[model samples]
Target: MNTSTHYPNAPVAQPVARHTLAVIVDNEPGVLARIAGLFSGRGYNIESLTVSETEHDKHISRITVVTSGTAHIIDQIKAHLDRLVPVHRVVDLTLQGEALERELALVKVVGKGEHRVEAMRLASAFGARTLDASLTSFVFELTGSTEEIERFIKLMTAVGLTEVSRTGIAAMSRGPDAM
Candidate 1:
């Protein structure tokens, strides 16, 4: 009898880490579904997802996915992504030191008097640009790291924040290398 040491069904007890993966894939129909399915079917949660065609002539799209998982799970995810027909390459941007990440957000605040002044002052302090302003409301545009955006939104809430729309993180490796 052969002894088996691997337990496929065993629960994993390991430290989970947040990672950002950039997948280069062909721009085609159903490609996004397949990528999303890979995560959904495996019970992996995608914290943030951004996809855009980086090469128009080549019909290639770059998909940036942020997720949390153990190291083993992350390796498995990368392997699976690499096996996809449309995927050309999978790079773990989190592992690449000094990767740059940024997001854009539009925040709308509704208030008058002190609230309005305070909100504008807060926005100005954060380098948020006023996109629109009226007697009762102002829409501000801000772009920065995710943490910065979160902090700005939280402070806005105290100053009559009414709505916010965000563009998911757009990231890339810094310096001379291209992922």
Candidate 2:
């Protein structure tokens, strides 16, 4: 006779659909490199990455990264990052709680008379500010979600897109909290 445990009412493990990680690290040299290396070395992909000095006196920087992976991979990534020397904290913004995400993009478009006017009009419609202007070129500054920035870029391309630069993404948890 069989005398083994026969409890078959357990739930299966599911993979995480998406994740946003917010990392607080010392604002020192090689910090970004080390973090990036951690991702590349382990074959993880970074959909978006944004970093900036949040506290000047404390010399602390915040890095917001968007990525997708299974549940196991996400835990692995967090544990690995936490073990880094420069990393002060590694938080999974998506799983831990609610957060706000934003990004800034500077889109440069070069066009002739009509296209130039059209580009400006489109940019205005998208709430993008014209940071710079010339007879044949214009630089529009836009800040919003990644989807919004992508929409603006797609529209600008139709009007004669020349170049674009994005400041990645910066995110933080909502409410009375600091992470």
Candidate 3:
């Protein structure tokens, strides 16, 4: 170990920041796939994606996508999404204020005896529920912010985590007005 007292003030390599985009679009087949293709074709990566019908009659759907890029690239993505015929609007929720983000994940763990007991105890601490359970395996349902979910998963991995299925992030402004 070099004991030289030297401290360099070099800037760290900053990865592109993440932004959550909420897209309101006409609910139709192939729309989600199209949007995904647009990102993949352009060498962009989507960290999380969720789509659901917010209104009845299935006329409209909300697509929430979590992605990271430079400011200019993010702006370009917003513009391109807006140009899609089916997309009514694209809102960068991260740029907006006071947004509430939540996600649901099903984490499966397989273990025996103490491992199983420890898993349940840990899951309880995280407020996760057993959606499915057997002697050798358990499927836990957890809902929370991204960080919370990630932490829970990390803990589960050490306790015999088997797999996970996430519903992505659903976010909205927390105010009287709708986004």
Best by lDDT: 1
Top candidate, metric TM-score: 1
The RMSD of every model to the true structure, in order and in angstroms, is: 4.8, 4.3, 6.1
Error of 3 at 174 (Å): 1.4
TM-score of 3: 0.88
* Model 1: residues with Cα > 4 Å off, grouped in runs: 1-12
The C-alpha lDDT values of all candidates are 0.94, 0.89, 0.92
Residue 9 shift from truth in candidate 2, angstroms: 13
Cα TM-score per model: 0.92, 0.86, 0.88
**Candidate 3 Cα misplacement greater than 4 A, ranges:** 1-15
- lDDT tens readout by residue for model 1, 1-179: 44364665677479999999999999999999999999999999999999999999999999999999999999999999999999999999989986799999999999999999999999999999999999999999999999999999999999899999998888899989777
Residue 34 lDDT (model 3): 86
In model 3, the Cα lDDT at residue 60 comes to: 97
Best first by TM-score, ranked = 1, 3, 2
User: Which pairs of residues clash in candidate 1, taking residues 3 or more apart in a chain or in different chains?
Assistant: none
Which digits, one per residue and each the tens of the lDDT, describe model 3 over residues 25-123?
999999998899889988899999999998868689999999999888899899889998899989999998758999999999999999999999999
